[model samples]
Target: MKNYDVIIIGTGAANIVADAAIADHKSVAIIERGKFGGTCLNRGCIPTKILVTAANRIREIREAAHLGIHVESVHADWAAVSRRMWHKVNENDSIRTYYEQFKNVTVYAGTASFVDKKTVRITDANNHTEEITGTAIIIATGGRTHVPSVAGLQESGYITSETFFGAAYPPEPYKSLIIIGGGPIGCEFAHVFNAFGTHVTLVQHNIRLLPKEDESVSAYMLQQFEDYRIQVHLNQDTLSVRTENGEKILTCSDRTNGKK
Candidate 1:
């Protein structure tokens, strides 16, 4: 059994707590199921922003006509963008290396489950198990994409934010994309792909994009989406997704009138 002054379940916000514990002359143990940097660093905000930056640049160049600067052609090199994103976000090994350098810090690459109030069992990829107890346990495990239960969604296959930036990331921009949900992630992806020359259709269960935000903001975003030539479906409830004749198709019903 290994013991520590502090045990952190994840490497996301827990990193800050670990540093604090280390500064206080405490031994720290970090157990991570996936990548060391957790969601925002590994698969979420940071990587998504990298792609968004490229998309924004392409949109800017294409829309430069308003400033009397006519750019004849705007091209997005998806391979280069993807390479840069992967390069910047591939810091898992480095994070582990840095943590390992600290004699008082131990990094475990695995999932952790509680054995008792202060003790936890860690199971690694190879099914190896270890027991560790800590005076202080910090559970900073982050969030994941919530995939709704819809017919044929799983069998037909789809990518969430996790897989979208991971090994399963497509080599080239998709020719077309159907994005469900109208919150930040879906809308951002829609803009990015549409700017990169992918036909984008965004379906929102709510009547407006960014439904939680102010109505004016939603209205403005909807207008901007229209200006970008991105298809927007409001108040839509996705029924199912299927692939037929080598084409992916999504079936949705109008939420307001319940018409398919």
Candidate 2:
């Protein structure tokens, strides 16, 4: 059994607590099941937004004709976009190296679960297990997408934000995309993929996209999505998704009147 003054599970925002403890001469163990940085850094925010920025530029150029400025043939290379984004995020070794530089800190890569209060077990990739006990253990395991229980959806190979951005080889720029859930992530992806020349259809169960935002703002954003040539299907629940003849098709029901 390994012993430490502090055991911080998940190298995310919560793991920053170890910095102060380590500064006070306390030995700390930073446990992470995945990469050194958490979701925002590795998969979610940082890298995805960078791609979004590039997409925005493409949209601007394509729309430049309306501004009386003729910028011809502005194209977005999506495979290049996905490739470069991952290349940049995966290339960073600063976080891991910085943590390793301190003799008082230890980094463990494995799945961690509590055995008892103040005791935890970590199972690595090879299934090798080890127990670590600490005076204080902090769990900062971040969130993952929760897929809903829908018939044929899972087997249809539907892609979520995580799998799309986290894959080793992302899809080679599909010509069309049907994105469900028109909240922030879905809207952002709608903009990105639409800007990348993909025909995007955004479906939302709510009456409008961005349900959590102000009503006026949501309406304006929906207008913007329409202006971007994105097909918007509001107040519709996806009944099922199935691949038919080498193409995936999504069936939906109008939630307002309970009709398909």
By lDDT, the best candidate is: 1
Model 1: what TM-score?
0.98
lDDT of 1: 0.91
**Cα lDDT tens digits for candidate 1, 70-189:** 988987899999889888788777987888899899989899999999999999999999999999999999998889888999989998988887767888989999998999999999
Off by over 4 Å in 2: 168-171
TM-score of each: 0.98, 0.94
Instruction: Give the alpha carbon lDDT tens digit for every residue of 105-131 in model 2.
Output: 988889998899989999999999999
Q: What TM-score does model 2 achieve against the real structure?
A: 0.94
Lowest summed lDDT window (length 10), candidate 1: 159-168
Show pairs that collide, candidate 2.
none
